[model samples]
Target: MGIRVAVAGASGYAGGELLRLIAGHPEFDLVAATAHRQAGAPVSAVHPHLAGLDLVLTATDPAGLADADLVFLALPHGESGAVAAMLPTGVKLVDIGADHRLRDAAAWRRYYGSEHAGTWTYGLPELPGQRALIAAAGRVAATGCYAVATILALAPLIAAGVVSAEDVVVVAASGTSGAGRAAKTHLLASEVMGSLAPYKVGAHQHVPEIKQATGAASLSFTPVLAPMPRGILATVTARPTSDADPADAARTALTTAYADEPFVRVLPRGSWPATAATLGSNACHLQVTADVDSGRVIVSSAVDNLGKGAAGQAVQCANLMLGLPETTGLTAFGTAP
Candidate 1:
């Protein structure tokens, strides 16, 4: 028998993506899927692409999920912590929400306006010394989409002590899917199509997450909504520690950091990362350059917000936690036109 898997919040976009990946995984047996208001409905009713799945949506309750060996919580922020507390400690749990990503309680309360749920082992495997933690922890907190992109863009330079993290700026454009599957007036196609607008400018919740993950001294993050359905393109800039060949240093740092990482790609010189190149896959495309005149290092990174940014990331952590190969059921190649 395969490892029994259960997905909570199955009606949402991240949960649906988890379901898709679980269906394709060889070891995971998707035995239960839960949703809030959609309970008692067929899983296919909300996720048409998963029409072949025969399971009905169950209410998200601990008793209902007790049978599964592994559980994936894709619920909204402020929700997963409670559900996780109710589950058995022996079961592996991965949270794809903001509840447990931050180690500072003050930071979590400031942004989420709720009690801190306590931090879990961060789920970004490519980060230095992070894989070992994820492989041993029973609970993992997947990083946010924007946080992952920005952290991946800057961590190499910060780790190499080549960039001053005191003043960092990140401007990212994300597809509408990052906003979640909820229905809101701002997310309507009529308003979002053919328009590029910025929201949560100075106070995006992911700001502290990036700072915590990369050990950046200070950061200003601005997220823009693009007119597409998936992916995130993040442009990050920071001051370098030295003026001598900062570009070459940044490149060398990135190459050394991700040399053995399967999902992160440092692109060729003069080439830039694009959201389209990472769409529908667990890949993050990165490119870096140094502005000698301005004494700044600029890095561009791209990833599928719903893929590597959320569901794919959660799955990747799960594989490690189970002692399985990191890329067992995940893909690094995007679907091209």
Candidate 2:
């Protein structure tokens, strides 16, 4: 028998994506899929793309998920913690919610306005020693969509001493799906199309996560709501610390850090990252250069919000936790037009 798995909150965008990914994973057998509002509905009813999936959505409960070897908690922030605590101790968990990603309880309480859910082994494998940590962990917190995009672009620079941690600025644009599958007036087709709206200008929830993962002491984060359906394009700029040419140094740091990574691609010089190139894949496309006039180092990173940022990330960690190859059933190639 294959590794038995389950997904909680399978009706939402990320959850549906998780269902889709798990369906294709050869060694992972999806045993149960649970949802709150969509309980008793067939999985295909909520996720039309998963039409052939014969499973019916059950209510999100520990008992329904306990039989699985691993469970992916895709419930929204503040909900996963309660359910997670009740799950069987033998089941490995990967939470794609914001509940368990922060290390500092104070930060968690301040941002989420609730008690800390406690930290899990962070699920960004590209980070130093993180792959091993995820493999050894029973619980892993998948990196936030925005957090992964920014961290992948910023961490190597700070770790290599090519950029100063004190002053870092990131302006990121994310497709509307990052807002989740809920119906909000602001997310209306008319409101988002042809418009780039900036929200959570300074106090984005991912700010703390980015700093914790990248070693950035201070950050100015601006997140934009794009009109499309998926992907994140983040432009990160930081003060250069070395005398070496900023572009060369930043590229060297990024390339060196991700040299052995299967999912991170440091694009060739003069080529920049775009959201489309990373669509439908777990790849993070990156390109680095220096602002000729300001001498500041700039790195542009792109990723599919549902892929490297959430569902795919959870699957990667689950693979490690289950003693499977890190790249098992995962791909770096994106579907581009």
Candidate 3:
């Protein structure tokens, strides 16, 4: 028997993606799936893509998940903390929500307008020194889709001191799926298709998480909703610390940071990242350039918002937590048209 696992919040997009991945993982035995309103229905009723899965949707309660060796909580913001607190101490938990991503309590209150639920070991494995922490952590907080893309795009330069930590800006475009599977007027095909719109401009909840991840003192972030369904392209710009060739410095920093990483790819010179190239994969494609005219280093990164940015990342951290190979049951290649 493989590690028995359960997924809470199974009716949502993130949870469906987690189930899709778990169904193929050789070491995981998906034994339970839970949803609130959809309880007692077949999982396929909500996630049509998982048509053959025989599991029924159970109530999202601690007792229903007690048998799981690991539980992935894809609940909406502010929900995971209470559920996680009720689980047994030995059960490994991964939360794909904002509840545990920020270390600063004040920041959490300021943005989420709720009491801070406390922090978990962050789940972005590619960040320097993060994999080891996840390896030993029983509870992990998977980074936000937008925040992960932004952090990965700028972390190397920030860590290398080649860019000023005080000044950074990121404008990222994400497919509609990043908004969750919840029904919303703005997410309707009529509103989202053929349209590019920005939301939560200066005050996106992911801002504090980005700062926590990259150690940036100040950050301006904007998230754009694109017409597609599942990818993110983050364009990050930062001022260089010195007059050195910012492009070369950025390349060296990114190369050194990701040379041994399995999921992050630093694209060759002159090649830029495109969301299509990373669709449905856990890979993050990256490229960097310096604009001498603007005196800034610009980095672009692409990833499947639901993959590397969410579910796939949860699986990655789970692998480390369980002592399994880092790339087990995960892929780097995207699906092409």
Candidate 4:
């Protein structure tokens, strides 16, 4: 008896990724799929990769998802709140958008300019104090794609007192897919190929989410659109705190944080990671080093922005909610080519 799951906004990339991860999950059955614009069309029309699945493209409705044991909401940020509000209490809900992530309403209003969607337990399983919270939460909100990489790369240092909340900088490059499945001029192949450009500099929405998660009040975060079609590589550099070991502390901090996590791996010293290393997968690969001359610790992180950052993480939380093993369907392996 697999847990029955429903996916709202099923025609999008995050939804398709959720479907892909759950299609073979030993403990889950993907029962319902919804998409507002593509309703009444075959799911394959939007996501050709899911051509053979027995899912229908329907509008997001509470009734269609009534029988689900769990529901994964892949709707756009502002849209999840209304849908989540209508679902039944017993059905566990997991949101892979920004709606329920921040605990502060003011911050939410400032960044998103909307009414606060009540906070849910965050879905980053590797955060030191977060797993227990997720295990007990009935509703969970997955971390933002950029925030996932940013938090994972910086949390350990913050926790270990190796970095302060002031003077931090993060610049991340992401695939166009991270922008979502919508049609936009900038994401067109003609505009994207043979080019890399930065967008949403200091004003990126994920900035507040990152600050809230890492407890870093002063952060300079920027996101760039890379030429590729998947994955995120975030380069973060921060001045070391007075207490930082100054030798192996940066590596030790990250290692200690993810040493036990099934999905996060800190690469061996000096072995730089690449986006291709984590494509089509649910792993977050990272490497950290300290620049003694500048008294700064530089950390680089990679993740399938659509995978471990969004849908794959939604599934991982669903597994926890169902009391099944965390790695039931996800693997740390990456595609090589």
Q: Which structure among the candidates has the greatest lDDT?
A: 2
lDDT of 2 by residue, 188-260 (tens): 9999999999998889999999999999999999999999999999999999997888889888889999999
lDDT of 3 by residue, 1-337 (tens): 9999999998898899999999999999998999998999998888899999998999998998989999999999999999999999999999999899999999999999999999999999988789999999999999999988988889889999999998798999999999988789999999999999999999999999999999999999989999999999999999999988888998999999999889999998889999999887899999999886997999999999999999999999999999999899899999998
Summed backbone clashes in each candidate are 0, 0, 0, 0
TM-score of 4: 0.97
TM-score of predicted structure 3: 0.99
Q: Each prediction's TM-score against the native?
A: 0.98, 0.99, 0.99, 0.97
lDDT of 1 by residue, 1-337 (tens): 9989899998998899999999999999999999988999998888999989899999999998979988999999999999999999988999999999999999999999999999999999988889999999999999999989999989989999989989998999999999998899999999999999999989999998999989898998889999999999999999989857888999999999999999999999878888888887899999999765787899999999999999999999999999999998899999887
Residue runs of model 1 more than 4 Å from their true location after superposition: none
**For model 4, how does the per-residue alpha-carbon lDDT over 1-337 read when each residue is reduced to its tens digit?**
7788999988889998988888878778888999988999887777898879866788888899878999999999899999888888998999998999999899899889999988999898888778878888899999999999999999888878888778999999999989999999999999999999999777899988888888887999889999998999999888888754643787888888787889888998779878999887889999988776787889999999999989888988888877888888998899899
Put the candidates in lDDT order, highest first.
Answer: 2, 3, 1, 4
With candidate 2 superimposed using the best TM-score fit, by how many Å does residue 53's alpha carbon deviate from the native?
0.5
The list of candidate 2 runs beyond 4 A from truth reads none
TM-score of 2: 0.99
